[model samples]
Target chain A: MKKILVAAFMVLLGASWANAAGTAAGTQIQNSLTLDYEVGGINQTDINADDGNGFLVDNKNDVLVTTADVASVKVTPGSTAQVLTFTVKNEGNKVQDFILSVSDAGAAFSLTDNFNATSQSIFVESGTTPGYQSGEDTETYIDELAADGEKTVYVVASIPASQVNGDASIITLTAQVATGGTASSQGSATVNDTGADAEDTEQIVWADSAGETDAVEDGKHSDASAYEVQSASLTVTKGSCVIWDPANEGTNPKRIPGAVVRYTIQVANAAGAQDATSVVATDVLPGTVTYGVGGSGLTQIARVVTEVCSCTSPGTANTGNVSESTGTVTATYESPISASETQCAYFDVTIN
Target chain B: MKKGFLSILLIFAFSSIVYADVSIKSQSLQEKIINKQTKWVKATKVIPGTKIRYINTMSNNGTVMAQNLVITNAIPKHMLYVDKSAKCDGVCSITYSVDGKAFDVPAKLFVTENGKKRVAKALEYKAIRWIVQTLDANQSSSVQFDATLE
Candidate 1:
């Protein structure tokens, strides 16, 4: 009879050790003690008593937010769609929803925060695809995020045209704990359970530590990321060299009457994320000089100019439009002068 | 054989006349922030990961001393026993059980994992037993163990 009872107790012990996030709230941990003793060398009956009602497990609410980008996302000025990614993880012991928001007031990256991005929008990454997709990841706020579950969130914005190269816009993503259970909808923000502890019901407690902008136990967390402007910087310079003359042709040509001079206008852009487009260079010839002896008097080209104002390489000819009217030469280079590229406009004139 | 059985029944009845009465009672406690200080109070607001202390008091209420007093307690469900937290106020030997059927010292408890037998962790302990040599009349002793809610 005693062996059967002992075996039953062993079975109960094995069932209670199942792994979980924690014991569910309001679970009664009933326990009793069994005492066996012998008096005067005689075995006595066992004694047992009921321990006081066991305590209930309270609610633990915690969350973590971290920026997924190692560095600020590079964007060009006037970029329509730029993204900064973050991760929101539910560190609590139960399911929860998170209300998400983005703010321009945040910690800056290595670059100075000088501008604010426009049309800022938040998105929750869909599990179907990774990273930010314009039309794919459309969910704004997190819903029904399970314990230890994390979702990638994107802060999408547009870079204004006025924002120049090296300008940065910092964006902060904040997630506030909210009531969970419903799907496809935003839940109300959760307040920590307060007042006297109730043994029958699970009480909510804030267990999260501090994040970038949130205090400890505040049921919310925040992290910051940035978008830095990486626009093209273009510079233009014009130089002229004597080409031919009646007396000293192509050799130490003088700035005298009938001396022909070749003019070169160079437009160079530094290596950057954007390209300069619709580049037009114009030079007004003096009354002492006339348009080139050749037809049209203008030829648009491109070259790698190493020394300042020095043009030597016969670069590939550009498909730009060139026109000369009343001794003034205008050349519109091919559209979109790419980064780390130099384009030059060449025209010749004769001293009259 | 009938006469021998009758004599044994009489001896059992005589021993019952000089019996020792033993009683057991249990209590559960949890830590709470009361006023400005943290104190161990009756578990009122319990939650996951809360550390609970289960205490069992054993007392001898009769005129004779209770010999070989053994107190056994099952670690509560949904809880993990804390290592080295079992204690007894009197001179006693304490052992643990993983399955509640086989009790052994902490060093002797073993569990099989991946076809290999390894020493059981404190969290795997399911039951605790404490044996005291004797409990004198009108004397009470308590045994306690701490566990954290899973």
Candidate 2:
């Protein structure tokens, strides 16, 4: 009876130890079992024996994971080609092969506001362990990335020449792990056989398990940058010409009292990609000069030329007023000056 | 406890005695031409060589009058001071400084030119000061000067 009871107790303890051996993925589960036995008679000494003490075993499974990141960039409109960079890391316990793709965020290419991707494929850096050889690989292939390994990639893009101010473009990069044949397989496989004597090929089968063995999770990252157009460089030039004799017209064209001096103000936009808005030209005649006047002390005025003198069509005429007390003259442009365009204004004052 | 309460009361009384109500406002002006008439227009944007007028208005809003009030303004960079353009309405003394440190009348202000002491040119004036003897409560006064952008 004692021997039977000891055998039953050992079996129960083995079952309990097996139940506590299950553990989370990616970690080893080590366990051991020990047994002690004793035999004795009521009047005699006891004999003891210990076996299977400190005998340990461990088990684990692989896990698959990945992540990606992209860096933002800044460039000016009409600038040369620029680079967009990204980093893809593999956090799984096995090697992974990643394929790359780049696309704009939904807006079709247009002349007013858009960016152009110069290359359809991404290029990986060279000399990286398990990385693709430079210049030989066109597609963004990782070849082999060890566990917790990462690779950097570069994509070239250009800003359209006609891109307007404050224009922006968002570029998304996606990396997907390749899976298929023996070369491209995902997760681990299991096999099961019911017959006692089965063929070697029939005994082994693939089990489609999802976690670490041959498994891969796709990674996606996106970044955007804006093209800032600079302000136009507007230059103003003023020139003065004197008219000494009013009645004689061409007589005495030098500075003199009671002479009328005509002034020309030219405003030009120097930048080819920018335009000037709300442009106005003003000039305050010095204390020595007074506003030209006609009979009965009525003030005289001048008109601004709307178009360039070289143009064949007559330019629009803008009128300017003179202040008798302050000797100020002003002319406001009716339209904004386009890039690389020039506008002029004319006014006249009398020498005090 | 009584001594601490009295200290708090004394601090409040000192703060009230030190506080005074006075305000200063400033603006820039430019001459505008309209229908052959010169009008003073608020200067919003000025270009090189444009003449700008700066007016500073001081007001005493407190119940007690303000005494020995002095107002000073430094000439802005890239600007040339117009000669004899500073003006004030009250019985005040106006002074000019070439270095923004020493102040005196225009005739007395001097600068070392070529190792010789000479009267500073109007364009060399760096700062302006106005000294008012007294300003009655609820009264306001204005000071103005003209400068040309270089």
Residue range A90-168, candidate 1, lDDT tens digits? 8776778999998876785666778999999999998888878887998999999877789999999999998877789
RMSD of each: 5.7, 40.6
Each prediction's number of clashing residue pairs: 6, 8
Cα lDDT tens digits for candidate 2, A258-281: 667767777777756366667777
TM-score, per-candidate, Cα-based: 0.81, 0.30
Please list the residue runs of candidate 1 whose C-alpha ends up more than 4 Å from where it truly belongs after superposition. Answer: A1-21, A108-111, A126-130, A133-136, A271-308, A311-347, B1-19
User: Which predicted model would earn the best TM-score?
Assistant: 1
Query: How does candidate 1 score on lDDT?
Result: 0.77
| Model 1 steric clash pairs | A22-B150, A23-B150, A56-B46, A57-B47, A58-B46, A58-B47
lDDT for A73 in candidate 2 is: 50
lDDT of 2 by residue, B49-137 (tens): 45767777767675556655565666654457899999987688888888876779999999998999999999998777776666667
